[model samples]
Target: MHITFEKLLYREDYQIKLDHIVMNEENGNRLALYFRGHTDEVMVLIGDYSCNYFELSFEADCVLLRSSDLHELDDGVEFNTIPLVLYKDSALLTFATAWMGLKRDTSRDWTHYAIRAFEQDFHVLSPRPPVFTDLGHKMSDFTVRHSFNLPTES
Candidate 1:
C-alpha cells in the first residue's frame, strides 16, 4: 500500500513511536526508519539519497514538513497539501525544526521530511516519496538482519 504525505500528516490522535533508525551512507546514503503506531509497524526507506540533503539533531518533539516563501509556485503548498515543498514561514514553525533552501524545482517530485526523535531529528528533502513497506514481522527482529545500533531513547 502506498502511503502519501497527506495521510501521514493528518493523524491527530496517533502518536507515532519511532522504533529504529538506520543510516547507511555506503548504500547511496540510504536512510530507513521503523515506526510503530496506529496499528502496525512500517518502514520508511529513503534509498539512493546521496544527492539529497539531510540534517540530524539530538532532540526533537515532533516532525513537520518545511517550505520556502520566496517563490510564487509555493502559493498552493501548505502544511498538509500534496507535492510537498517546505518554506520557513509555513504553519510548522512551532512543531519542529525546518530544512531551509532555495526554491524547489517544480518539475520534479519532492518529499520534505522532518522526523523528530529522542536521539535524532531527521530533516530531509528528496526528489521522491520514501518507500513505505508494511512489516511482516516484529521491528526488532527485522532490524537484526541489518547491523544498526541507535542510542536508546531515555
Candidate 2:
C-alpha cells in the first residue's frame, strides 16, 4: 500500500500545532511528537512507535533569530511558523522553523519511514505505520511506555 505524508499526518484543517517532542532508545527506538489544540480541542500524536534509527539537525535561522523582523511578513506576522513538511517521496519530514529533518534509514534493506525538519533529519526503519492518537480535553491522560536496561556481557 502507498501512503502520502500529508495523508498519513492529516488533520481536519491540515494544521499541526506542535507542543513537544519525546524520544527514547531503550528496548527500541521511538519518537513521539505531541500537538496541542489550536483551532480545535483535540491533541494529536504522530510517532514512529518502533523504529531502527533516527536523527536531528538545527539551522541558524531557527536558533539565531535575534528579531522577528528577520522573516516577518507584515504586522509582525510570520510564514512557516512551524514549517513542517515532507520531502524525498514523503520519506523526509522536516520542520523548517525548528530546522530539523527525519528520514528513512538508507542502509537498511527493510521498509522505512522518515521525517525531517529544515536541516534536522530523522530516519526510522519500520514497516508499521506511525502511531497516531487523538484525545479531546484529555491531554494529561496520554502515555507512552519506554524502558531502558543495561546490556549483559556475553
Candidate 3:
C-alpha cells in the first residue's frame, strides 16, 4: 500500500492533523485514517522509531474505511485525520500501526473521545506523524498542552 499526506492547522487538543490517503496495488483498494495527538503522544509514538532525523506522535482517534463508499459508509472514516507529533522522523508509519487494532479498538476511551474532548484532552496510545522536508511554519509557535499515557504491560 501507498500513502499521501497533508498537515492541518492547530486545534484545541492537538497541534496538527495528519491527513492520509492509502492505496493498495493488487486489490486497488484504499484506506484512509488520521491521528490527533499531543507532545506526549509524540514521545510514545516515536519511542521506538529509528527511521530518520525526527518524527511526530499523537494520541490518535481514527475512522477507517474504503474510498469507494465514503458516503454510504457515513459511519465516519476518520483514521487519517488527527493531529500528529514529530520525532526523529516526520513520516506516517502506516504499516507499523496496522496490526495494532487502533481503529478497530471500540474500547470506551476510544469510543467516547469526541465528547470527552470538550471536558479534557483526548488521549490515546497510537500517535501519528507525517513526513515532510518543511511545513513552512515554525513548530515552536503552536504549543498546546501535552498529555500522554504509556500503557503498562500486563
Candidate 4:
C-alpha cells in the first residue's frame, strides 16, 4: 500500500492517492480497493481527533495507529482506520489523556486540562531527535515483524 499526497494547498485542502491496495486471504485469494478524496474537514481522516490535540492523550493505546504502518499494508482489505495524528511523538501525551477521557466521559474538559498538562510535562521530556540514517531499515524490520500476520491482498 502506498499513499501519495498529490498536492496540498493552503486552503486546508489536499488530495491523497492510494495505490497497490491488495488483500490476500489465507487461501491465496486477493482483493483490491482504491479511492481518492479531498476534504476541508479534517475529521474525515482524523476521526475523534476533530477535538483539540491536547484532549487526545486520554484515549487508549488501541485508538492510535501509525500512519507509516498503514501505508505498508496490502491495500484492498478493510481494516479499522484512525487519525494519523498518532504518528507524531509530540501527540503521545494527548493520546494518553484522551484514553482516560473516554472512560470518565469527561472529554469536554480535555482541551483545557491537556494544555496544562503539556505545559507541565514539556520540560520533563526532551524534544524528539531526528531519526538516524538507518531508520528506514529498522522501520522495515519492525513492520515486517508486526504486520506479518496481517492478511495480504495479492
Candidate 5:
C-alpha cells in the first residue's frame, strides 16, 4: 500500500510489519507503543532526538516524520533507523510526550529527558502506560512474517 504522509507517498507495509514485530517477535511483553493524540490525529513516538520530533504519522497515513526538525525539511526525515531502550528480554520506546495543550515546554512530556528553563539537562520520569481494557487493540494490525528462536544451552 502507498501511504500518503506529509505530502509524500511511501509504499511500504509499515503497520503490518510493525505489528508483527511487537506481537510475535518482542519477547516477554517488553515492547510497548507510546502514542499521542495530537489534535484530531494520532502519532506514535519513534525516536529520541531532543530537538527533533520523530513519530509515526497517523493523520492520513502511517509514516515516519520529524515534525519539528527544520534542518531536515529539505533532506526529508530519516525513517530507516529509530532509537529505542534495550531491556533484559525485550526493547521498547525510549520516551514520548503526553499531549496536553499548546503550553510551555516545562509541561511537555518526553521519555528520555526534558529540558527546563534553567537546567540544560533532563527532567527524567517514568513511562506512563495506557489503561487498555483490550490489550490486543494496541497491536491490532496483526500479521505473521517470521519467528526467531535462540539455541538453548545443552
Candidate 6:
C-alpha cells in the first residue's frame, strides 16, 4: 500500500487547512502494512535532520503527524536529520535517539540521542532497504515493499 499527498492547502495565516490524502492498497493487510511503512519513513526523515523534530498524534481512527522548526549546524553544513517525539493521544512513547546516519558518520559527536518512555509498549519492526531513484536535479524518490504472514484460527 502507498499513500500520497498530491496537494496541500494552508491558510493565509500559515496554518494547515487541508491535505489531499490518497491511499493505494490491494488488501486489508496491505493497508495496515502501508501505514507502518509510512510511519517508518517519517521517523527516519525526522531522525536525520538532528535539529528538526516531529510530533505524531493519533485520534480514534486517524493519525496526525507534523514536522516543524527545522535547524542545522552553524557551519553551513547541510545535515539531513530530524528529532522526533512519538505520541499516542496525550501519551509520549519515545524520544528518538541518534541512531540514524550515513555509514561514514557513525561517530558519537554526529550521533543524536533518543529516549523511550517506560509506560508505552511499542514495537518497530526491522526496516527493509528502500528503493531509491533520482528524479532529476534536487529531486528523488523512495519506495518500500512489505509482505506479511496470514493469520491462523484462534
Top-TM-score structure, candidate number: 1
C-alpha TM-score for every candidate: 0.38, 0.30, 0.18, 0.16, 0.17, 0.16
> Model 5 clash tally?
1
Candidate 1: 10-residue stretch with minimal lDDT: 46-55
Query: lDDT tens digits, residues 28-127, model 1?
Result: 5566666543422122221211111122222122232223322333334333321223344432332222344323344644344554332334445454
Against the reference, the lDDT scores of all candidates come to 0.39, 0.33, 0.30, 0.25, 0.23, 0.22
List model 3 lDDT by residue over 78-105, tens digit each. 4433432222221122322355454454
Model 3 clash number? 29
Instruction: In angstroms, give how far residue 77 of model 3 lies from its true place.
Output: 16
Q: After superposition, how far is residue 83 of candidate 3 from its true place, in Å?
A: 7.8
Candidate 5 lDDT tens digits, 60-102: 1111222242243232223321122212111111212223221
Q: Where in model 6 is the C-alpha error above 4 Å? A: 1-22, 29-60, 65-82, 88-154
Question: What would the per-residue lDDT of candidate 6 be over residues 71-119, giving only the tens digit for each residue?
Answer: 2212122322222212221211112222322223334221221112112
Stretches > 4 Å off in candidate 5: 1-16, 20-76, 83-101, 110-154
Q: How many pairs in model 4 have backbone atoms within 3 A of each other, for residues 3 or more apart or on separate chains, i.e. clashes? A: 24
When 3 and 6 are scored with TM-score, the better candidate is 3
lDDT of 6 at 21: 24
Question: Each candidate: RMSD to true structure?
Answer: 13.3, 15.2, 19.6, 19.1, 19.5, 18.8
The CA lDDT at 8 in model 3 is 27
Give the number of the best model, judged by lDDT: 1
Off by over 4 Å in 1: 1-6, 25-27, 39-110, 116-121, 137-154
TM-score (C-alpha) between model 6 and the true structure: 0.16
**lDDT per residue (tens digit) for residues 49-149 in model 4:** 22211111121112323344335433232322211111222343344455555335442322211011111111111122211111111111112235658
CA error at residue 151 for candidate 1, angstroms? 34
